[model samples]
Target: MSRQVKGVVSMRKGAPVELRTVVVPDPGPGEVTVDVKACGVCHTDFHYREGGINDDFPFLLGHEAAGVVAEVGPGVSNVAPGDYVVLNWRAVCGLCRACRRGRPWYCFDTANATQKMTLEDGTELSPALGIGAFLETTLVAAGQCTKVDPAAPPEVAGLLGCGVMAGLGAATNTGEVGRGDSVAVIGCGGVGGAAIAGARLAGAARIIAVDLDDRKLELATTLGATHTVNSGRTDAVTAIQELTGGFGADVVIDAVGRPETWKQAFYARDLAGTVVLVGVPTPEMTLEIPLLDVFGRGGKLKSSWYGDCLPERDFPMLIDLYLQGRLPLETFVSEKIALTDVEAAFEAMKRGDVLRSVVML
Candidate 1:
């Protein structure tokens, strides 16, 4: 049987999302239906609204979410009904070449629901990141639901589905920040702040946060930043070098996804220090850096796709840490709004008023 539920939809480009009846079909083979509990309003959702992701009109926005499995279809066994789970976009296929090489995080084949969710009028909806979570109930691939500690609040746990995980992975996994190392994260927003927290978790002795906004810089301190630099008022690279004993940081993370920020991250690192770019850039954006400088750096320059994270391996462990109070995942939830307020939350995000405004369904 099909189910009709209220969902936030981007009907057209640059138009406000509409709350309309979404027709969700029963789960098919390898699929599962989820009862969404909470979802975060991320910038990516806004990008989808603006047709930045694609011209896939009437996109079912919201990907960072937590929920419980309501039903599972044939061949689904990783999760069951009534199980608490964090929704993840990366549902890695074990047979992929990356998985065959023992690196499932870079799996080329991820899964999504074979059937599409649509409007009452039968218009197919393009789910955001293959997990349309702003609705009361959503259908997704069974592998997309990763079982986690149910004790963690959905509002906090859902954040791991995207931005938070990206930042933490940027520092811990991609950048390989180590004990007593000096680290600098450019852009003190949600993702950058998480990188600071991750650096702290990794035992970084000095963590410098560089951002244009003073409020975000201040927030970074609570997230474990040892120093703050207002990039708008100062040269970020120079300040980072000055703070790191004139040697530059051991790890520099570019979370802003801008050419200028990338350059700063490149120059702000010590020789052979890792530079991790976790921020997403637009298609037309380009960088013009000298090949000689790239060669002289002599360190890893890498792009972090979804923070190089494997949801099944990382989500449960992260949730356990959150419950233990070691990881302050709750700090990322700046506000909790009703599902109807997602559009307003987008405005707040645009104005830099909150780290995250989650929608409680």
Candidate 2:
């Protein structure tokens, strides 16, 4: 049977989202229907509203979410009804070449629910990042539901579904930040702040946070940033180099996703150190760095796709750490709002007012 539930939807470009009846179908083979408990309002959701992501109007606009499995279809054994899980967009297909190479994080064939969710009029809605989570109930691939410690609050745990996971994974998985290492993160928003926390978790001796916003830089301190630099008032690369005894940091992460920030990340790292770009850039944005400089850097320049994360492996472990107080995942939840307030949350996000304004379903 199909279920009708309320969901926040972007009906048109540059317009406010509408709360409308969403027709959610019963799970099919390899699918699961989730009772969403909480979902975070992220910048990506706003991008979709502005037609920045694509012309996929009427998009179900939430992805960072945590919920319980309300039902599972045939052939779905990884998760069961009543299991608490963090929803991930990356549902790795085991038969992919990346999976065959034992690198499932880079799996080329990620999966989504075979069936589509629709409006009351039968218009198909594109779920944000393939996990439309703003609704009361959502259908997704069974593999997208990664079971975690149920003790963690859904508001805090859901963040791992996207931004937080991206930042932390950028440091731990892509940047390889390790014990006694010097790490620098540019952009002190949710993702950058998580990178700072991840660096702390990885035991980085000195973690420098660079951002244009003083407020965000201040928040970065609480997230384990050893030093903060207001990039607006100072040169980020010079400050990072000076902070690391004029040698530059071992790892520099550009969480802002702008060309200027990427260049700063490149120049702010020491010779042979890693530069990780975890930020999302628009299609038209281009880089014009000299080839000579790229050769002279003699280090790794990499783009972090979803933080190179494997949900099944990382989500459970991260939830456990959060429960143990080793990871302060709760700090990322700046405020909690009802689903109706998601439109306002987008404005707050634009003004840099909150790290994450989660919607409690």
Candidate 3:
């Protein structure tokens, strides 16, 4: 049977989201219905509101979420009702070419609900990142729900579903930050801060954080940054190089994802060091650099798609680490807001007042 649930929706471009009664259908085969417990407000959700992601109107706009399984469709054996889960945007399909090659993180065909969640008028809504959890309840492919320890608070664990995972994976998976390595992360927002934490977890000898905001830099320090650089008042590249004995860092991550920040990351790394881009950029942005510079750098320049994370493998492990009091997952939850306060959260996000304003359902 189809059920009615309240959800935050972006009806059109530049319009504020509405809490409307969305009709969520019962899960079909290989799908499940989740009772969303907590969902975080992320920049990507705001991007959907401003039409930056695409012209997918009436989008259900939250994806960084954790919840409990309420119902499971026939043939769904991966999860059962009452299981706590972290929703993942990437639900790897085993038969994809990428999966065939044993790299499911880059799986070309990820999973989503075959049926659509709709409005009272039957207008289909695009679930943000295909695992929308802005609603009281949501439907997703069974593979999209990764079960984890239920003892972890929903707000903290849900962050691992998106931004936190992106930053953490960017350092551990893409940047390959290792013990004794010097790593620098630019942009000290949730993603960058988590990158700093990830570098620390990976045993980075020196973790330098670069950001324009002094407040964010302060937060970065608490999250394990050994050094902080306020780029607004100094040359970040030079500052990083000087801090790392004039040789630059072993791995530099560009979490701001702009041409200028990308350039700084490119120039702020040691010879043959890796540069990872974890930030999301708009479609119209263009990058220009000397052709020889790319070759002369002689290091890897890569982009992280969902931090190259495999949800099933990473979520439970992160939750375990959080339970062990090692990951400090609670640091990411800036504030808890009601579902109606999503608009206000967006404003706070714009002013850089909060890392994540989560909605507790």
Candidate 1 stretches greater than 4 Å from native: none
lDDT of 3 by residue, 1-361 (tens): 8999999999999998999999999999999999999999999999999999999898998999999999999999999999999999999999989999999999999999999999999999999999778999999999999999999999999999899999999999989899999999999999999999999999999999999999999999999999999999999999999999999999999999999999999999999999999999988889999989889979899999888999999999999999998999898899999999999999998999998999999
| Candidate 3: RMSD to truth | 0.6
What is each predicted model's overall lDDT from 0 to 1? 0.93, 0.95, 0.95
139-214: candidate 2 lDDT, tens digit per residue: 9999999999999999999999999999999999999999999999999999999999999999999999999899
Query: Residue 63's C-alpha lDDT in candidate 2?
Result: 98
- Winner by TM-score between candidate 3 and candidate 1: 3
Counting only residues 3 or more apart in sequence or on different chains, how many pairs clash (N, Cα, C under 3 Å) in candidate 3?
A: 0
RMSD of each: 0.8, 0.8, 0.6
**Which residue pairs does candidate 2 place in steric collision?**
none
Candidate 2: worst-modelled 10 consecutive residues by lDDT: 278-287
User: For candidate 1, which ten residues in a row score worst on lDDT?
Assistant: 276-285
